[model samples]
Target: MTTDPLSATFAALADPTRRAMLARLAEGEATVNELAEPFSISLQAISRHVKVLEQAGLITRSRDAQRRPCTLRLAPLDDAVDWLEEHRQVLEGRLDRLEVHLRTIQQKNQEHDQ
Candidate 1:
């Protein structure tokens, strides 16, 4: 079944290897071989990770001569950040209201004791 862009992005990012590959691409474009260099996994594995990133719209691959270099795409990351920031604001608001209620209850208890 097809997934939403945010779901697909999160799924791809759930893998540490794919996240690292994205980090590398952030620095600059890189071939699968270059991405594989730092890891002990085979080139095939790195290529698979690259494919996941590409499918998630997190990266793009282009052919330059015989090399296929992958470049990072920031749109998906920006989407994720926007979603997180929205939810963080909601949670913070909820916490602020709860804190106020607790303080009011504490003051009531103190008055009753006095």
Candidate 2:
């Protein structure tokens, strides 16, 4: 299926296995077998998860002898972070306006109570 790069990235990251794989890769690179070690699932499962990450461009796999070692690329993740941060700033601005409004209302209530 076709998706925007950011959507593809977030979708790829939606799985816990993929997230774990990414976490493992963050320590550097490892073959599929090494990445599969921490989990109870089969190596095939881990390979599929790695494929998702590869499709998302979050990881890169290079051929080292007979093994394809997956390495963390991370460049695509910046788009996801940037998207979240943009919305966060907008939400914070709305919250700041609400705080000011509440403060004004509280001050008026205090003044009228006198």
Candidate 3:
């Protein structure tokens, strides 16, 4: 259930469970059983989440005997953050202009009333 890195990232983030898994992984690596312990769901569900994260390149799984430890791979998120930052900057600039415009109108209205 994957298309590309961007699509995979967006798809993985579409589910709350996967996001939580990433949050937990941010602290450190964990096995499937360890990740499953925090949620009320089963380990299978956590496995699915880990798979999605892995596909998104937001996480990785390594074999350690019988345990497959999940680790956060946050490098991919840097691109996402940069994208968001650019959009945010544009919106903030627009808002600043709107504020200035509103202030100009307000000042003119005050002068007219006086």
Candidate 4:
């Protein structure tokens, strides 16, 4: 199946494990073993999660001697935030318009009563 970058990003983020890994990487880069330490899952499993994050452009793994440390990439997240903020502004504008319309109706009713 085909998907856009946004969809891919959301799909990658859908897993709690992946999200936690990203959260950990937020502080600093960590090796696969370091990321797996808090979880009961196998190192292989953590590696798979890291792969997903890497594919989604959410993280990057760099070579540090024999260890590969994963670092969080904020560009994809910033894009997601921009998309959400745009939609939020649309909703806010709609709500503001609704509020004005309601006030106009209330005023008309008050005038009719008087």
Cα lDDT tens digits for candidate 4, 1-114: 777888878889999999999999999999888999999998889889998899899999889789888899999999888998999999999999999999999999999999
Could you give candidate 1's per-residue lDDT for residues 1-114 as a string of tens digits? Answer: 898999989999999999888888889999989899999988888778888898999999899999988899999999999999999999999999999999999999999999
Q: How well is each residue in 61-110 modelled by candidate 3, as lDDT tens digits?
A: 88988888988987788877787799899999999999999999999999
lDDT of 1 at 80: 96
Query: Per-candidate TM vs. native?
Result: 0.93, 0.88, 0.84, 0.83
What would you estimate as the lDDT of candidate 1? 0.92
RMSD of 3: 2.0
Where model 3 places Cα greater than 4 Å from the true spot, the runs are 1-4
* Top of the candidates by TM-score: 1
Clash pairs (backbone) in predicted model 4:
none
CA deviation > 4 Å runs, candidate 4:
112-114
Tens-place lDDT digits, model 2, residues 12-67: 99999899889988999999899999999987888788888999999998997898
TM-score of candidate 4 relative to the true fold: 0.83
lDDT of 4: 0.92
Q: What is the C-alpha lDDT of each candidate?
A: 0.92, 0.91, 0.84, 0.92
Tell me the TM-score of model 2.
Answer: 0.88
Better of 2 and 3 by TM-score: 2
Off by over 4 Å in 2: none
Candidate 1 similarity to native, TM-score: 0.93
